[model samples]
Target: MLRITAGKLANALRGTVSGTSRVAAVRCLHGTEESAEEFDKRYEKYFSREGIDGWEIRKGMNDLLGMDLVPSPKIIEAGLRAARRVNDIALAIRWLEGCKDKCGDHQATLYPFLLEKISPTLKELGVPTIEELGYDKPELALKSVYDL
Candidate 1:
């Protein structure tokens, strides 16, 4: 799990720095940096009733990305590769799909690199032509080609 600092969360959410001051105080009182699980629990307790927007969640993830608290790109790539190598084509496809969802325009640039690694396995999967995959239309293609 990713551990994020309260200040980082505040900055990412564009919330008042003082919003996380209480959380920071709690951490200090506990004599240890709070773990992500603790922060998530507090977030639910403090914010679940407040009706926060999806943008806030996006911001928090962005902050985590900026702080390198989220999984590294190399780690993600390696996992994708491993999934393909292990003949877990569904897992590899989901991994790439997630990359496209999270990275957006940047995904196009990254896709070629990932494709170089997994295209053969993808072909073996017998669904989702490369063209469909590149266009982010894997499901339709998969259903048509593989009847799945």
Candidate 2:
């Protein structure tokens, strides 16, 4: 298996790869010809710095491809907290949206928390629930409800 740096993996996710070349490289290094032990060693080396970000992407890909492994709740919670800290409402919404599939047990718990934060603004705009407004068109929804 070919060893890859965490920074290289992160950069690839951020569009640094530009095309199929990086995929080809990774495949050549760790694909069918590589043994499971070699792949595990190479992956561990990359996971050191990429950390949760790397794991999250791996989980997402698994979900997309219908693989069975799920991400840990801790990672989801940390992502939600980070989104909240940054005041990134859309990101927070997406985090919650994505969690719906993997964290069904905690979905009810998150609703009240989200409602508490956005309720006032939602009410002021006469929107009853987040489901009533198109997240992509929040401004338009607010304007329609409030005649703004």
Candidate number with greatest TM-score: 1
lDDT per residue as tens, model 1, 1-148: 1456876786776765564665465455667788766645543343232444444433433433333133334444444444544455565555555544555466667656656655565565543533665754545553456564
> lDDT tens string, model 2, 90-117?
6545554554444346656765665566
TM-score of each: 0.32, 0.28
Supply candidate 1's per-residue lDDT for 34. 80
| Deviating ranges (above 4 Å) for candidate 1 | 1-14, 17-73, 84-87, 113-135, 138-148
lDDT of 2 at 71: 32
Cα lDDT for residue 109, candidate 1? 70
Per-residue error at 119 for model 2, in Å?
A: 16
- Candidate 2 achieves a global lDDT of 0.47
C-alpha lDDT of residue 29 in model 1: 60
